[model samples]
Target chain A: MNRSALVSQAEPRDFIALLKPRVMSLVVFTALTGIVIAPGGVHPVLAAISLLCIAVGAGASGALNMWYDADIDALMGRTATRPIPAGRVTPGEALAFGLVLSVLSVLVLGLVANWLAAGLLAFTIFFYAVIYTMWLKRWTPQNIVIGGAAGAFPPMIGWAAVTGSVSLESLVLFLIIFIWTPPHFWALALIKSEDYARAGVPMLPVACGEAETRRQILLYTLVLAPVGMAPWFLGFAGLTYGVVAAAGGLGMIWLAIEIYRRREGAAARKASGRMFAFSILYLFALFAVLLVEQGILARIL
Target chain B: MAEQPTEAGIVLTPEEKRRQRQRNIAIALALAGLCVIFWIVTMVKGAAILQRPM
Candidate 1:
């Protein structure tokens, strides 16, 4: 069958799927947390606008990624059902959709929020779409290590939307996600190494072997443990945040250790799956604690 | 006149046509909502809106 002929007419739902709503939700949550924890004020409406722009920009990046990666996505079992690869949307259509959303998001953010926030949003789109997707993803095993910066930018952009400037506090938030990404992704890579290998993408486990990838996941988690607690230690957060960070950091390290110790068969896959699932909760709990301390609890007390 | 078919020669059934209409309406509504938002924001910012450093 002719590949182009396989493409069906795209529906609105297909376009929505192209946006990768699950990934966009994570971006929105973390970015909203950044806004809540920042040590300044923005009008409620403006804050909402900033969040909307961030979410759209993240979606735009996802769409562009899907368009460019349609080939590999078709090959990989995990991504084969995605809109472009599933023949529900054409790559040209995805490209146009992403590009339009990218421009609209940046322009709207700049008009409603400060240009600094808008610029960060723009750079984030470029970093994810071009730098990570186009260049690093296929080229190196360290792709997630460096490309993690794209995901890390959202909080900083959110903080800038509120304060009109980047601060040490926002950078701490950035560093937390940046450091957390490697372990989070490597755990999944350990399980999906075959998918990545089939797609010709040099994920850590595929490129460097599972044993080395597991070791790297442990090392990154060790570093993340201290860095994740840095905000609480530095007094940017309260005692409640401090406790949650300590507990979550310990949980993350334990999971990483489990992944390292159980290195074969179904046990290893189970360990990696547990680590990946817990990593999401770990990051979410850290930010949720901060949001409560700085946004809600601060207001109440 | 015969109904025009898509380039793929797939003619839309009535249900598909209804869905396409709904999608177009949704897109229009979303665009209208965005314009309304921008207008409200501009009003709120007022003279200070132009003072933004690009």
Candidate 2:
């Protein structure tokens, strides 16, 4: 073996890429909303630290996921350019990085915030790394349906950080994300069914067929629309939030209907693509509204 | 004397060396940030930082 070939050529950016920053950003945003919305406020510094810990923990999960999924990632066009699959970072290096960050983030969160948050963070990492990536991903078509719980946890963890316990409100936040995941992912799956089929991953579109996937997308969206508005109706938010949620929920439903109605040609692909794109906006707008509303209320009262 | 190879008996190329340096710097910065956070939290907690909640 050539010693020269054994030396890593990975850059620091590759390490960052391993963390899945885009996913981390969403986690941070949702978690931050959780922190801000809790009744009694946290110290600004502590809150910042908690957010940091959550973000790093989420990143750690991402790294661990990439480390384990490298082979399948290499096969899928969507994931082919990931750090490990792209040959920028080794799986061993990614695993080490993930493990180190996971421990550090959890410990720091426990020390700076509360143990509940830390415990949730730890479980979130374990779920994403072990349950979802290692076990569920290749085994079932319903992989993301259950794996979405890992993503749903941040806001609850954030709420726990502030209140030192879980509550109904936090669980509602969790429910919204959990329901939203199926439609959001299935729309993308509808488009990239071939990539998933190639990777031997049993996403709904690959395993259950496109018609079933589209029907499921519509079903989940119907559920998500009402759940997305629960925060407003539940009294944590004001009229603006209610209005935005209602509008976004309608938009999501409309797009989902389009996805269900249009079933072939570029029109079908376009419907799926539009649904995929709009789902992101729908979720982002929902969280952003909650964050803004709660932020202003927190400041005023 | 020639440049020494690492304990693994592999010589790092110039690009590898540069990246290693970059990673080391990032690690140092991260450590420093953690220290600052710990210190600030200690000050905020004011001698009761150890009384953690379950």
Candidate 3:
């Protein structure tokens, strides 16, 4: 095929891939939880709009991340097939797509929801694109630790969409994700240390050895276990949430311990993989329980 | 009358051209839906859209 023909062959799916749909799903879920948990009423349509904006904003962040990290992504096995790296979409296209979506998401959110939420959305795009992607990812082993705040903001932004202001409650939701990120990501980093090392990214495992990474993961999980139960203790969530959070937190800690113990061979990889997988479910179950308690159960009872 | 140079210098296969048409239609429909949403929001908010908060 000719050059222009090859360029013209870029499909809509390539654009979607730029969005990082999996990451966007997590953002959507957490943001929805925030919307449901916030102590107020929002029109269903407006709530839907707010969620759309959050999802699009998340997509924009992913696109920008891909644009910036295309080089490193090409180096990493796990990311070698991303749109930009695969040559299905150019970096310029991804940059323009991201910039357009970022502005559109923020503007529509400001008009439809509230400015506070929109501002938060804009800041999230900036934080992920500039601070995390451009700076921390290349510079520090604590990249995911500090960069996690960008992901954590969606819930707060969702909460602000309704309340027009941040509250202690919203901060609690933010804290849960912020604290949860390091251990969750570190587990994956342990499994993918070679990928990070190859890509020249200073992930904890790549920079500090696997043992230290495991130790930090255990420490973070220890802190997260209690904080995960905060919604229950704070009285916003019901007994269901408290029980689930406690159980899930223990499960996470157990998995982290397993990860810490099994550190030599395929057993270590399996343990790390299990911990990473379970961490996702742990967060999802915690949020799902909270959503049911605050949003559904509250409405019924 | 005229075929505009939207994909200038980029020749597309028939399948790509078909997909492009589909995408264009989808985008147009989405824009229309957005217009409807804007109308509904304006109607719902009414004076509040312009009102100053004290």
Candidate 4:
């Protein structure tokens, strides 16, 4: 993370760094799932390109976000080492890079798949960079709540790539991510309240007391659990998806309760961290289970 | 102790403004290239689809 260490390399990884590879990977996986699970088939080459664009677009959004938040990022311990904050990339450079990539991703996906998918992808980058980061982030406790919709678009975009329109299945995928974001992020916010506080970001835990935040998390999970099962209930997904989603929901609730119960100490903090980490795993699993059931396991199970 | 010396809205230096302009131009150009490519691909795909027998 040291700037000097990264600076001397003759070859710069600057372009690759912009994409937020960790986030891109998840976006790729979910988007791919959307393509495969949707009704019609996309040509393999086109599918590859579409997914590539989605990844690039997601990265572009991340870069733009980093550009805007560079000052705040440097202040927060967790974000201080990002390329923009570390001075590896300038804010203008990052913004330009992101803007270029965002345009490319949307166009490529539109060309390779459908304009609808590309249009959605373009809107997603806009929502994330302009709306979420530029407008909503510093202004509201609902930052992640509303901003969550932007991240939730990948699977929908992927589904659109195949079907060329939105459907019940895609919406369900959107709902899972939408509902998951608050609790998932709130868990981290609970732990990193100091980082957000220092940055003057009005995250939920900082705005409302810990108890109220915990209540909000639990309430969101209560809604999320039911929404997660909706695909199965609506007949877009199989029973296995229902069962797994139900289990994951309960598991998430259990951790949320533990977080609420143990709010004051190292153990409570660790519990929140545990939930934050597990929530990620839970989402991936929930999607993976949906894919398996709808595509492969539907026949056997 | 390590916060940026300037506040969030500090005016960009001349060098920074120049960099920003260049970046803006580059982004605009890249976006144009993407549009060109997207159109070409879609046209090719559409032609192929139309050629196919129903």
> Candidate 4, residues A1-301: lDDT per residue as tens digits?
4433322221135556777888888898888889878886667766777888888899999989888888899999999988877776767767877888788787667657778998899899999999999888999999999999999999999999888899988988998899999999999999999999999998999888678888888889888888888888898887778888889989998988888788788988998898899899989988898778775565456
Question: TM-score (chain A) of candidate 2?
Answer: 0.97
Model 4 TM-score is 0.83
Clashing pairs in 2: none
| Best first by DockQ, ranked | 2, 1, 3, 4
TM-score of chain B of each: 0.71, 0.76, 0.68, 0.65
RMSD, model 2, all Cα superposed? 2.2
Interface RMSD of 1: 4.3
TM-score against native, each model: 0.94, 0.96, 0.93, 0.83
Stretches of candidate 3 exceeding 4 Å from the true structure: A1-6, B1-10, B51-54
Task: Give one digit per residue, the lDDT tens place, for model 2 in A142-244.
Answer: 9999999999999999999999999999999999999999999998998999999999999999999999998999999999999999988899878888999
Instruction: Please tell me which model should have the higher TM-score, number 2 or number 3.
Output: 2
Task: Sort all candidates by TM-score, best to worst.
Answer: 2, 1, 3, 4
Q: Where's the lowest-lDDT run of ten residues in candidate 2 chain A?
A: A1-10
lDDT of model 3 at position B45: 67
Question: How would you encode candidate 1's per-residue C-alpha lDDT over A84-150 as one tens digit per residue?
Answer: 8888687898999999999999999998888999999999999999999999999999998999999
Better of 2 and 3 by DockQ: 2
Q: List the residue pairs that clash in candidate 4.
A: none
Estimate, for each residue in B1-54, the C-alpha lDDT of model 2 and write its tens digit: 123555757666687899889988988998999899999999988877889999
lDDT of 1 at A3: 32
